[model samples]
Target: MVQPLDSRQRNRYSRQLMIDSIADSDQRSLLSSRVLVAGAGGLGSSVIQYLAAAGVGTVGIVDDGRVKRSNLQRQVVHTVDDIGEPKVESAARFIDALNPDVTVETHATRITPDTVASLLRRYDVVVDGLDNFATRFLVNDAARLAAVPFVHGAVYELEGQLTVFRPGGPCYRCLLPAAPDEETVPSDEPMGIFPSVPGTIGTLQATEVLKCLLDLGEPLDDELLRYDAADATVVRTPLEPNPDCPLCGSDEIDDMDDIDYDDRYRIED
Candidate 1:
């Protein structure tokens, strides 16, 4: 049962509460939902910030790295004081400072195949802030199999893209069936980052998550949103599922158990 909002909640969320679309009941739902952000880097900085500010009741953050002086350029959630601290721990501190009502579960570990599904299953929505292609595919495939909603966002310098993959809908695989050959894929870290790019994409990702939680609008399940920061232009293109998509195609990939994501995946013939 949904609980009544206390006076403190009313005061804390006064502005959003006044929003006709997100009134009292919606605020209560936000305070009761759970979201999992898969990385704690540039994109995560913004995703985590907005989710906490909006009062998501439980948030699980997973990152196996530590903060470094080099990361401050775009990782706004960490400070120089947290340089050596684990990313998840620093993210938890940031969330706690912004909203004590939030419960943070920190996993200072990588997202390997063995643990990805179990981690993602714990939340209502999964926000993709990962930096590499392999892990992104791992998440897409896993979320599709688990029937969970995955909000994907990626920023490379001044360009980025955003899309949503909900249960029974087209997934990331439907857009890109296979990772480029090892030698052709981009490096783990982009050549350069126009800091604001991540903030833009990540904020949009948070918006999609909220929409999914509230069921307030149409999802981007069949479309892809792309952004170009240099000229500040955005293009929303229609995305059609590939009839031969490896994950949800004529030849479906229902199990991810033996898929070697590190080697960029393969569907045995």
Candidate 2:
């Protein structure tokens, strides 16, 4: 049964309550949802901020790294005071400060195959703020097999992309079937961030998550939303599930066991 919202919630979410689609009942649903953000860097920073602000009942943050002075450029959730703290801990603190009604579970560990599915098992939605394609594929496979929704976002110099993947919808694998060589894939951390790149992508990702929770707007499940920060243009392209996709079709991957995401990071054939 959904819990009734108290006066405090009403006051906290007053502005959002004004939206016709997110009136009393929808606010209650948002208050009862659980979301998992897989990284605590640039993308994770903004994703965590908006989800907590929107009053998600439970927010799980998973990151194995500590904050550094350099991370402040785009990691909006962490401040200079938290420079040496672990990202999950810092993000938790930020959420607590913004909305005490939110319950944050901090996992100061990496997203390895052994822990991915188990960690993701309880959340209603998994937001992929991860930097590498290797781990993103692992998350995509786990969410697909578990029949959970995965919202994916990534930012390069001045470009980024966002998409949603669920049971019947196209997945990351449907878009990029095989992991590229380490040398060929771009690194998650850039020499210098444009600042707004992550900010833009993360906010759009949060919007998608909220839409999924409330079932209000159309999701980007069968399309890729790409942003070009320099020119401020967004292009939406249609996508379809690949019948031969190794992770979601005839040759579907059902679990993380058969894949090796370690140094080589390849799907086992």
Candidate 3:
């Protein structure tokens, strides 16, 4: 646990604290809050950088990928010289250089069902910067089990979607009852997303995480915000809690270990 910073630290964040919605205590909450960001790629890059700059106390980054030349296009934290370096390591270095006040933990491994629960239990909030449906579902279910809130974002082509999953609000499974067919869901390699797509979505994820931590404004709780960068239009839609939602529904979930992804998502051969 991190103790609150002294007057010097508080002075540094004074401008932000001035916002009526976020006072000194809220700033302290941000400083003491811990966030776990999955995937240190495009989206994670922005999420991690912004949160660290905002003085988030502890940030945990999980990524098995290496910084590639291709990633430099969107992953602002990594430069051409960083190519071939482990993403989590690279991200941690960037955060440290940006703000010594933030303590960063790097997990240079892929997130799997066996590891998700334990990883989620360590953080106050989780940011879904993952690119695949499989991992997204894993994070969502794990966060629900840990009873922690998560902000999710997805980017494909020029479009992006973002939402917040509060304990009582609708979980991601409610909106995406089933993962898209593997054959239909394009991989980041082939899909070739625009750099700005995840940049925008990831920033929104960071914003929501800060708001949630500080108990600030109206969170997306039961709503999804979609952005069309080409048209510069954002559309908001309400998400209703599914009575049958296996993860956060009315039905009792006997055990976290018992929840199966295959039953929830229709994966095609």
Candidate 2 versus truth, CA RMSD in Å, comes to 1.7
Superposition error at 188 for model 1 (Å): 5.0
Show model 1 residue runs off by greater than 4 Å.
186-190, 250-252, 258-262, 266-269
Q: What is the C-alpha lDDT of each candidate?
A: 0.86, 0.87, 0.85
Q: Which regions of candidate 2 deviate over 4 angstroms?
A: 186-192, 258-262
Q: Which pairs clash in model 2?
A: none
Model 2, span 1-269: residue lDDT tens: 77788999999999999888788999888888999999999999999999999998899999999999988989999999999999999999999889998999998887877888898988999999888888888788889888899999988888999988877989898998887876776655455568889988999999999999999789888999999988999999998999887777765455677555555455666
Which of the numbered candidates is closest to the native, going by highest TM-score?
Answer: 2
Candidate 3 residues 153-268, lDDT tens each?
98878999999997878898898877876567654444668888888999999999998888878888888999998899999998999987877775566546676556323322
Ten residues in a row with the worst lDDT in model 3? Answer: 260-269
Please write out the lDDT profile of model 1 over residues 39-156, one tens digit for every residue.
9999999999999999999999989999999889999999999999999999999999999989999989888777888888768889998988778888887887877899999988
lDDT of 3 at 12: 79
* lDDT value for model 2: 0.87
lDDT top scorer: 2
Decoy 2 TM-score against native? 0.95
